[model samples]
Target: MARTRPRPRPVATGCLMGRLRGNPWAILCVLSLAYFMAQLDISVLTVAVPDITRDLHTSFDRVAWALGSYVLALAVTLITAGRLGDLYGRRRVFRAGVVLFTLSSLVAGLTTTVDQLIAARALQGLGAALLIPQTMALLVEAFPVARRGTALGVRGTVGAAAAVVGPLVSGLLVTVLDWRWVFFVNVPVGTALLLATVLVPDDDRAPGPARLDVVGTLLVSVSLFCFAFAVSQGERYGWRGWFWGLVALSAVAFAVFLRQQRRRQSGDPLVPFELFRDRDYALMNVVSVCVSLAFMGLVLVLSVFFQSVLAFSALKAGLAIVPAALCSMVFGTVAGRLSDRLPAKYLLLAGTGLTVAGMLWTAAGMHEGADWPRFVAPLSVIGVGNAFLFTPLAAVGLRGLRPELAGAASGVLVTTLQIGSMIGTALSGALLGGGAGSGPTAASSRSAMVLFAVVAALAAPACAASSRTPRAGGTGDRAPDEDAGRAAAGRSPCREPRPSGPGRGQGGVPR
Candidate 1:
């Protein structure tokens, strides 16, 4: 009898190359559109707040719920959604999120009352939370590691551009048509994107046997909710009693969550402790949180300053951010490309330095009578610095993660970002005190600038930490080796070991 010939398996390189040649740009477009819609929704409504308030017959403070509620919901559920995507399938969750977001946009557009709009916005946030983590996970699964930096750069650029365009577009719509149009516009665009997403092939990788950690999720959600609420409402409620009480409670909840997570003997933890075992991943989280805090705080302060202090209209204020946004988009791509070739730590450090310098300059020069051009120069510098930080920091955080942990890591990364934004906005708002002041306008500007400078300064240590982090697959990368050795020795890598099964992918896609 003759021996049978064995069938050859397709090479990963050939498979990936074939996919790229066939429909590479399609996925990028879909992902970019999703990201753009999510970011645009967040910033676009800012300029329309006054109009929304007028139409809803609500006060400015009540109108803030239009933004705050969405953010609060997003911050609370972001991690849970990410983990859920990892557990089930990213594509499924992402598609569902897009549909939900589209429906919510319609609800918001048709809303007649303040309560209706707020509920719609909260729904929108929930959809966004589901959408964001899965988007990154899809990108990671679709793109090779060598190209991830570029992909992430494109994502960052689109997001930043959307932020810049949001107000300008919203101002035009509100001025010419109605504030509701801002939400209405998303309907057509989102519908098209949803149809397009359906054509994108799903990566139905096998999932691990790890079950969801319901208690951990609840604890973390409560903790983050309390923390975000405390930060956001601290000024209104008074920092001494209710604010501090919530803060303390949040801390305790966090502690309890950590303890419970550590105590788990089986099932998937809401956040795998092993993910943070990597120094780079841990440091990246810190850096991401700090950078987000600084960026959000600066944007909030500058938006108000540009309109109130510099006497710019809403459209002009939106346009003023254009240069910075453009600079960030340009620099972000450059930095991302450089990240593939150069040491990420140095790039991150340089970016942080530039950001710090820009913040300091802004702080020093922000006088009531300062020229707009002078302010633009510093703000543009800050944008450049942010661009520098965006891709490298992301690459650093996710550099060496295996395919299975991708979703969780991305979830944690985004969660940190949301937390940072909440904290930054809260801190800045608390200091600004509802943007009202009978004191010298310069004094108010100075106080905001100082707050920004302090946040920027915090990035320096994160930069240093990045420098010390070990790269994946490098000799110095001890965490992976340790985990591997533990697995080899029949010990579980997680704090609480469950029955062995497949691991999560590096991009947060199940495998």
Candidate 2:
């Protein structure tokens, strides 16, 4: 009987491993969850800003930096973090990011001072930057070309969902507990994300070790920080001389960074120019930025208007906005499926156009006597538009890119989004006269909505200019710039057959 003690169930264990490795859906689920956490953190603290200022006994200016600091750090680090994933392994970097994010959230929750909170938030941003690119790269790797659009659609929907839900969750937490619990909430979610990493197979890095572009990194980091800080703080500082100086410095640094990147193209550049060789990818970056700018700005304006102008409580304001999120969720599922069958450009055009109309409708409704009920229809319209917008943008924008360029392309795309969001937030805040004792005037709210409408309208042109995405069950899945991408990497022009065996190669394509 002792000898009959069962050996470890090797066959069962093997099957489990086999299923984990073979399943792309499992990978998508894990990546989507992690992405949701990153996105949720970005907006969750908006409702808590005033609470934080009161609790920490900090001036509004200092407390505001907590938000700006996180965004600045994230924007500055994203490109470098993506390249790091290329140099190292994506799954490994993703795990590291999860750990850093969780720990920083703990620190943020415990912090008693504005300085501590800002620092912790900055760390959280850095962690987010590290992992975000990997989600796109890994999704591309796990799914075949035929299903890639659907997968990206799902990821986009998750991001959109998380973003809209953040304020609702924050309002709930702050109402029941303290404001610090907004940060505290991430700890458990991040821990679960860490555990979920087991389902994400390790991504294959480049064949050889490549040195990071130290100078380019410094230059870009400085440029992004200076630009972001200048815009975010300009109104608070009364558009002082130093603000203009920072803007000038940012412009110079960015110009120099571009020049250096051009020179270093033969070597390892911080931003791979090869990514922009695909016309759709380049235009998509523009669309992504415009969309984020319009959306984030509108959210900021509406959130403040609801609480201060309508005199709703934080929780009530969040509830008022829930219809938009719910509508987006419902339509997003439809958009995802459609992306697989339709040309993404058409969807993008329709999405942006609808968003523009919705914003204008919403702006018209923003009057002195407005109630939450007046917003439901317009917000739902915007929600449906948003669902159509991002899924196709991601699916089409990234379609023709070389798998190897996934991280870099993702970084650039997301960096544009971050920069756009920062700009939108800052501009809307200035328009609202956030520092004024009185709340936003009806005129100011309407003006902000108009600004958002204008910005969203810009994406339509870019979408129209994009290359057509290959439809599933129709044309072949040949990337438009496949040969050009190979040549840019100094590979031979002769096409290498895609591997389909159990063995995997760089970027996790099967070999």
Considering every candidate listed, which one attains the maximal lDDT?
Answer: 2
Query: Candidate 2 residues 1-511, lDDT tens each?
Result: 0011221221223544443542567778889989999999999988888889998998878987898778888898998888777666778888998999899999999998899999999999999999898898778766766567777888888888788889999989998999989988889989988987876655544436467889999999999989988987787787899999999999999999999999999888889897787788889899988999999998888888888788888888888888778878788878877887887888898889888998999999998879999999999999899989988777687777666667777888899988888888878878896675755988899999998899999999899988665432211244448657867876433323222224554323434
Ten contiguous residues with the weakest lDDT in model 2: 1-10
Per-residue lDDT value at 455 in model 1? 75
Candidate closest to the true structure, highest TM-score: 2
The per-prediction tally of clashing pairs is 14, 0
Worst 10 residues of 1 by lDDT: 1-10
**Clash total of candidate 2:** 0
Query: CA lDDT of each candidate?
Result: 0.75, 0.81
Instruction: Output the lDDT of residue 486, model 1.
Output: 66
* lDDT, model 1, position 101: 91
Residue-wise C-alpha lDDT for candidate 1, range 442-466, written one tens digit per residue: 5676687677767767777777776
Q: Deviation in angstroms for 198 in model 2?
A: 1.1
